[model samples]
Target: MIERPIGRDVVARQRFARLFSLGDRRAPLSWSPGLVLGPDDPELPVSVAPLRSTRSYDSIPATITICPRDNLCYPFDSEDKWVAQEGLVLPPSLVASDSGMFGSGLEAVPVSWNSLHHDDSLAVLDSEPSVIILIDAPQLAQRPGMLAEALLTVRTRFPSSLIWAPGISGPDNCALLTWMGVDLFDLARLRHASSLGVLLTGSGPRKVEETVNEDFGMEAQCTTWVQAISSTRAAIREGTLRELV
Candidate 1:
């Protein structure tokens, strides 16, 4: 059972900012800006364990972290210390999928919108997962019509599940994706930008090499994103979220 409460009452034309309470002790995840934190163990509110991995820690309500077949972070191992210290326990969801695309042990059945026939695609939606990850997001990004169609299909079939699009975040598209009802995003692009020595300003990514050394770092980039998300959330609340896009 997904215990998380989505504040649909505040939704302005399918847009909303809500809180996801994991447990009584842990801080409830605030979606005043949607959850776009780092993809690290400490950053997540729910305890995540791969479905195929040995249980190193006691079972907690796990949000199956899905990854593509080629993703290096496959076979995610749970840290017993984090679970014990943080008390990040969650109820297990009934939804399950068999797609081998997940690198994490989480039972996320992958649904490739472009690869599967319409009937097969509809079958995947029957599980009604709390989160639906778009495995072929890059392809969807290239084809707006396909992305819209996929988002629409999922919204129609599973109105409640949060849509996640990995490897698709930056100053360029985060607000736009959130406007489209994407509830989750990976921090890969942020890390990539940091590695390239680029600073993410409101205008866009600027090469650090071209600017003064004092203003560039991962911390600065993360701060910028946090502000952007906060601003976007404010817009959503005011029903002006589309203006940011």
Candidate 2:
């Protein structure tokens, strides 16, 4: 069973900046702190397990796992089995929501801001999940105003939960999302960029084919993103997160 040793902590709180902890004390996830490094687990823990019946191959769903020793995994739906096989799996506590239409028996409820009217959208927030995943985030990103409004509403209503936006992180938008109170980010974007032969730098993504080295790979791009996240987290801790945005 997944152990929730503590509820949540407002280690650092600001307009859009928040530093908090989740899961068991022994392996608590310190969000917005900085880089997270942990001993490798031959068997990776499963923090939040989406029911297998809910699995969909067409869309990649992100799963957030927190281990007893503080190892964190944000494996996509595709990687669930591989991740669980490598560690002591802790099944997440299920929370129900209207957004469950995306998938039933989810640890974190999905929220589709555009799918529902303002009132209907607000109703989904009533379930009060510790983590809310934004469904179809790429599409939501197109409607910045709506996305911002939905994020702000969640921040105001469910101040305790961490907001997770999958398939939406990159050098261009990671800082902004963090500043807006999103705590968990998946590496799908980075992986996608790498597949396209793009190198993600601090300034933005660059085509490797256009650059000197055609041999650049996803590992290097991931490292760059990790560094960027580390820097962003540091800025949050220092209370200068807004400056980075």
Against the true structure, whose lDDT is highest?
2
Q: Judge candidate 2 at residue 134 and give its lDDT.
A: 61
* Per-model TM-score on C-alpha atoms: 0.60, 0.65
lDDT of each: 0.47, 0.51
Clashing pairs in 1: 50-105, 51-105, 51-106, 61-90, 61-91
Backbone collision count in every prediction? 5, 7
Give candidate 2 misplaced runs (Cα > 4 Å): 1-7, 25-106, 115-127, 209-215
The local distance difference test score of model 2 is: 0.51
Per-residue alpha-carbon lDDT of candidate 1 for residues 34-126, written as tens digits (9 for 90 to 100): 443433412332221111111232443233333211111212222111111112211112113333222221123334453233234445533
Q: List pairs with backbone clashes in candidate 2.
A: 27-70, 42-86, 43-86, 43-87, 44-86, 44-87, 47-65
Tens digit of per-residue lDDT, candidate 2, span 101-206: 3322223555555323322434554355545556556666775476677678767876776676666767667788888777766556666677787887777887
TM-score of 1: 0.60
Query: In candidate 2, where is summed lDDT lowest over 10 consecutive residues?
Result: 81-90
Please report how far candidate 1 places residue 30 from its true position, in Å. 2.6
